[model samples]
Target: MIKRFGVSMEPELLDKFDSFIKKYGYKNRSEAIREIIRERLIDETVKEGGGESFGTIVIVYDHEVGDINDRLVDLQHEYTGLIIFTTHIHVDRRNCIENIVVKGKNSEISALAQRLRTIEGVSSVKLLLTNYTYK
Candidate 1:
């Protein structure tokens, strides 16, 4: 069942939302609003789950750190069932960025990303996910 209700907001903000809807090619305000709500629900659901999740982990680090590359690769291999693919790019003379896609329990993926970020050379890390189970 779908329920409809009026939403009050500042005109300025509403204008921007209208522009966003136009840019995103949303058919109507209601459709755009529904998508936003669904996305938020899925996001919150993913965060609340202690079980399975699918997401990408991005990291920036310095390749010059002692054996960091090998260590990183080995660590990912250790979670072979979870790590799907990794894309690597050499940012500069010493810096590098890697995007790793993984699927597994949230705790497992979070722990893996945390461990990688704690490595001596890692400078940044980000995790993005969208996994929800109705059951």
Candidate 2:
């Protein structure tokens, strides 16, 4: 069942929200609001170490850096239980980008991302954590 309700907001706040929805390409306010709620819930759940979540860690680094590739391989092997897959791309003669897909408890995945970020030769690192569900 779907229920409809009314929201009361100041004109300035409402205007800002409308602009946000438009900027994000949300089809309607309801859809945008629902997404916001979902994302908030997921963030809370992940922070609480509630359940398994999926994540991807992207790393850009200089391949020529001393033994970085070897060190990365060793670390990945140590965390084989949490890693789903890894893809490597050569960005240039000296640089490479790696995407590592991981699935496990949020804390574990976060630990792996943190470890990668601390590596000596890593130029950039980002981790996208999600508890997204498909139904």
Candidate 3:
């Protein structure tokens, strides 16, 4: 069952929300609001670190810097249980991008991302956790 309720906000905030809905191509304010609420709930669940979560860690790095390739390989090996697979792309002669798909406890996944960030030559590391869990 769906329940409808009234939400009151300042005019300025409502205007901004309307603009956001239009920019995102949402059919209406209700649809956009539903998605926003779902995203927030998922984030909270993942942050609680009580259950398994799935996510991808994307990293960009300069291959020429230090022994980064070897370090990255070793780190991934250490978390073999958490990592599902990884895809590597050669962005340039000296740079590479890696997308690592992982599934495990939220804490474990977070730990892996943190370890990856500490490796030398890593220019960017983005960890995107989702609510999906594999059985």
Candidate 4:
């Protein structure tokens, strides 16, 4: 079942939304609005920290930095149940990037990201959570 509702906004906002629709190639306002709502709901659900969520933790680090590689491997080993798989990329001779796919409670994922950020050589750590259902 689908329910339709009305949204009232200022002309300026509507103009900007129209432009966004065109920029994103949305077929119409309804499609864009639906996506926006869905994203917001998913974000809220993930933020609540109770439900299981899927996300990727991406980290960039200098491998040569004191014991970083060993520490990184050790930390990841501790979260074997949460981690689905990890893809490591050698960005250069000294730097590496790892994209870790994980599925667990929001708190667990967040905790893992926090731990990754504290690693000595880690220059960047990013966690992006998304809804697990794919249609």
Candidate 5:
């Protein structure tokens, strides 16, 4: 069953939320709010630790940098049990983007992300972690 509830907030906050909704092209405030709540809950769950999760670590780097590409592949192989999918894209002649999809406990996934960030050529790394346990 679906239930509706009232939410009260300052006028300034409401105005900001309306602008955010418009920027995101949400059909209604409820939809935007629902997504925000779900994201927060997932964040909490992931932070609490000791749970299985599936996530992707996306990294952008310059392929010319000191044997970094080989190092990245070696690191992924080290955690083959956690790694499920990998996609590599060439952004330019010298630059590339890689998305490594992994599944494992929160700590293991976080460790993999940390290791990737330490690679010499990695310009940026972002870990998008979420649990398959969530429905």
Candidate 6:
């Protein structure tokens, strides 16, 4: 069920809201507002349980560091279902870039990220995500 309501606000507030929504590429104020509410609700839900989410994990590391490549391979194989695919680039003789596509329960993804982040030669890790249902 849907209900409509009228809202009254200062002109300055309305102008700012319009500008903000425009920057976010929203077609209309109502849809933008609905998305804002949904994002908050999803975050709250994810906090309480392992909500289904999908994200990419990108990492840059030195492949030569203490058999880091094999260690990473072992860890990735351990989480079979979480990783959809992984791409590797030999950035240099020693440096490598790896991007992993992942989808799983929130906790499982987070744990995989944590494990990767803890490895010694991992110079960088970036986790970009949207709750699977959102995008």
Q: lDDT of all the models against the reference? A: 0.86, 0.89, 0.89, 0.91, 0.89, 0.87
Give lDDT: candidate 1, residue 37.
84
Query: Tens-digit lDDT track for model 1 on 1-135?
Result: 878899999999999999999999999999999889877776666567565777899999999999998899889888999998999998899999999999888778888888998888999999886565532
Model 5 per-residue lDDT tens digits across residues 21-98: 999999999989898987887778667766888899999999999998789889989998999999999999999999
Best by TM-score: 3
Span of 10 residues, lowest total lDDT, candidate 2: 126-135
Task: Give per-residue CA lDDT, model 2, range 1-135, as digits (tens).
Answer: 768888898999999999999999999999888888888887777677676789999999998889999999999999999999999999889999999999998888878888998899999998887885621
State the lDDT at 92 in candidate 6. Answer: 91
TM-score of each model, paired residue for residue: 0.80, 0.83, 0.88, 0.87, 0.83, 0.73
lDDT of 3 at 5: 88
CA-only RMSD, every prediction: 2.5, 2.4, 2.4, 1.9, 2.2, 3.2
* Candidate 4 per-residue C-alpha lDDT over 1-135 given as tens digits, one digit per residue, 9 for 90 to 100: 778999999999999999999999999999999999888877787677667788999999999999998999999999999999999999999999999999988889988999999888899999898877622
User: Is 5 or 6 the stronger prediction by lDDT?
Assistant: 5
**Per-residue lDDT for 1-135 in model 3, tens only?**
778989999999999999999998999988888888888877776677667778899999999998999999999999999999999999989999999999988889888988989998998999898876421
**Runs of candidate 2 exceeding 4 Å displacement:** 1-10, 133-135
10 residues in a row with least lDDT, candidate 4:
126-135
Best by lDDT: 4
Winner of 4 and 6 under lDDT: 4
**Cα lDDT for residue 23, candidate 6:** 91
lDDT of 6: 0.87
What residue runs in model 4 are displaced by over 4 Å at the alpha carbon? 133-135
Residue pairs in steric clash, candidate 3?
A: none
Which residue runs does candidate 1 get wrong by more than 4 Å? 132-135
